[model samples]
Target: MLSLGVRQLDDILGGGVEEGSSVAFVGSIEYDNVILMHQAVLEALKAGKRVLVVDFRQPPSTLLKELRNHGIDYEPFLDDSLTILDGYSNLYGQGIQGGRNVLPNPLDLGITTAIIREALQGDEYDILVIDDVTSQYTLQSSPKIYIKAVVRLVNSVKSLGKTTFVAVCSDVFEKSDLAAILIPFDYVVEVSKGVVEVKRSLQPLRVVEPKFAYMRTRNGISPMKEHYQSLEGLKAQLRAGENGTIWLKDLRVQILEEVTERSLIETVYDFLGPEKGKELLYTWGKKQFIGYGEYSKRHNTSIEEALEDIFKFTIASGGGKLELVELSDSVIIIRGTNLFPSGKGYPYPFHPNYAGSLAQFLTEFTGERWEGEETKCEAMGAEHCEFVLRKVR
Candidate 1:
C-alpha cells in the first residue's frame, strides 16, 4: 500500500490506496480533484518512490511549475525517479524532444495504450498518475474505446503491483458512461467544495467524520477546518441560479447567431476557398461544442434523440426548422426549411461550409466520422435544404 501522506485520508482508506489497486478522483467544474492527485504524486516522491505521470491536460512544464509553487523540490527527481509522457503537446500539434516521451496521437487508443504499457515495462514505477483521463479520451475517441483503454491500463498496472490514480471531471462524461468507467476501480473518491467523499472502497469502512477538508498551501495539501456542515451545503453553492442559467443560455444564442451568420461564411470562403474554408468551419464547430460543455450531458441519450433536441433548440433560437426525415444505424437524413442559406442563385452545391459544420457536429455527437453532403439546398433552387449523412467507415 502507498501512503497518501494525509493522516485522515489514509485512515479513511484503512491505510492508503492499496498496491495493485486503482483509485479514481471524480470532480466537477467548481470542485477540483487534480490537487489531490498532485498531493499523491508529491507524497510518493517524498517517500522515494518512482512516479510515472501520463498527463493529457496540462503541459509538463506547467506541472513542474505547480510543484515548485507547492514548495516541492522536483529537481532531484527529474529523470531518475520521475518520468512524464506529455500528451498535451501532441494535442496542440507540437513535437517535444528531449528526455521525455511525447504521445504523437492521443486519438488512437491502441497506440496510446501501447506506449503506456511499454513505458511501464522496465521503469519499476511505484505509482502511475493519469490526469484528466476522461477528457483526453472523450475529445478524440468514442466512449466505448475510452472505457476499454482505461480498464486495460488500470488492470495492467494492478497486475504489476503498482498503485494507480486516475482523475476525471464529472461534467465531461455522461452519467452512465462515468458509472461504467468507475466500476473497474477499487476506490472512488469524490471531491467537492467542502468535502471529499469516499463512495467506494475495498476494505470495511467506518463512518467518515465531517472535519475532513483539504487546504492548499505553499507546502501542498494539508488538513483544514470543514468549510460546510454537510454535502448539501456544498451543492447549494455549486448550483447555478435560474436567472444566471438563463443569462448564459441567452448569451450562447447571441454568440452562435453572430458567428454562424451568412455574411461571415461568405467572407471566410472568399479568402480560404471551399476546401480550406470548410475545414476551418468544421474545426470551429467541433471546438464550439467542446467549449459549450452542456452538449456532453446528452452523451447517454440515443444519437437521434440528441440530434433532435439540438435541432429543436436551434430552430427555436431562429436557426431554422430542421426536421430529421430519416435515421438508421448507418445513415441519417435531415431536411431544413428556411435554413440560413445564402439567397444568391448558385448552380452547384454552395453550402459546403454549413455541411462541414453539420458533419463535425454529427461526428462528435455520435462518436463516428460521418461523410456528409448537401444533396439539395435553397441556393440550388431547391424548396428546402437536404443533407445526407453516412458513417465513414
Candidate 2:
C-alpha cells in the first residue's frame, strides 16, 4: 500500500492505496489536478520508492523546481530515486535536449508509450506518474487515440506490478470519453465546486458517497470537518456569474464584498473622532441586525438558529467566534474570543458594533427596546470580549 500524502484520503482508502493499482485525480479546469499528482510523487519519494514522472505540463527543470518548492530534496534523489521524462519540451517546440529522457514527440502516442513502457520495465521505478492526461486534448490527434494510450499505459504498468497516478481534467472530455479513461483506474479523486470528493476507492471497496469535502485555500487543501454540513448547505446555493459576480441562489441576491474589522474601524476613526466613530459604527451595525431579525421573523426561523448563522458568517469572514454565555429573562451575556484586533492602541471596549447589533437583534425579536454595555474587552487587556444586555425600563 502507498500513502497519497493526504491523511484523510489515505484513511478512506483503508490505510492507503493497494500496491500495483492505478489511480486518477480528475477535476475541471477550475482546479489544479496536477497538485495531487505532484504531492503523490513527493510522498512516494519520501517512502524511498523510486518515482518516474512523465510530465506533460512543464519542462523538466520547471518540474523539479516545483517539486523543490513543495520541499522535496532534489539533488540527492535525482541520481537514484527520481527520474523525470520531459514530455513538454519537444512537443511544445522547446527542443529535445533539455533532460535525461526527453520524448521526441509526446503527441505521438506510439513513441510516447514505447518510451514509458521501456522505462517502467526497468527495476529502477516503483511508481509511475503521468503528470496529466488532460494535455491529450491539445496534443493528441483524437479522443479515441488518447483513451487507448491511457489504457495501454495503465495495463502495462499494472502488469509490471508498478503503481500509477494519472491526472486528467474531466471537463475537457465528453461523459462517454471521460468514462472510458477512468474505467482503467482502480480509484479516482475528483475536485469540483471547491470540494474534493473521492469518487471511487478499491481497497475498502466503497461505492459512491459524498465521503468528505475540502476547501482549496492559499495555503492548500483544508478539510471542512466541523461545519461541513451547514457549509455544504450554504455552498449549494452559491452561483457564479460570468460578469464577475457571485450570487446567493436561495435568497436570489448578489453577494457583496466583505469589510474587514481593522479597515472599518480604522477608516471610521480617521473620518470621525474615536467616540463619534464608535457611535456611528454601533448604529450602523444595529440597523443591519434589525433587518436580519426581521428576516428571521418573516421566515419563521428560531432566534437560536438565526444567531448561529450570524456567528458562522462572522467566523467565516474572519471576524471571530461568538457564544451566548447566559440568557435569562432580565439579562443576557455574550462572550467573544479570538475577536478581531479592532482597537489596538485604544484602552477601551473595541467591539461596540457587535454589542449594539446583538442588542438590536434581541429587541427586534422580543418587541422591547434593549441596551448593551461591553463589560470586558480584549482591547482593554481582558482575555475575551463580553457584552451584558438588559431590557430598557
Q: Which lDDT tens digits does candidate 2 get at residues 1-393?
A: 888776556656666788899989898885445666666777788889998888888777887676565454456777789888888888777345555588878888888899899988979899999878887666566788788888988988999999999988888888898999898898898866666667787755322243555655432444543232255535755688667767654344554333355566767877887788878877876976767665444332345655666677777645778888887777888899877754545555678888889888878776778888778887777888998999887
Each model's TM-score, in the order given?
A: 0.54, 0.56
Best by lDDT: 2
Instruction: After superposing candidate 2 on the true structure, give the runs of residues whose Cα lies further than 4 Å from its correct spot.
Output: 67-76, 94-99, 205-210, 217-219, 226-393
19-131: candidate 1 lDDT, tens digit per residue: 66888988877435777777777778988888888888778888778767876666778788888888777677445333447887766788988888877777578788898
Query: lDDT (CA) for every model shown?
Result: 0.69, 0.74
Cα-based lDDT at residue 305, candidate 1: 52
Top candidate by TM-score: 2
Query: Candidate 2, overall lDDT?
Result: 0.74
Q: Model 1: clashing residue pairs?
A: none
Q: Residue 229's C-alpha lDDT in candidate 2?
A: 28
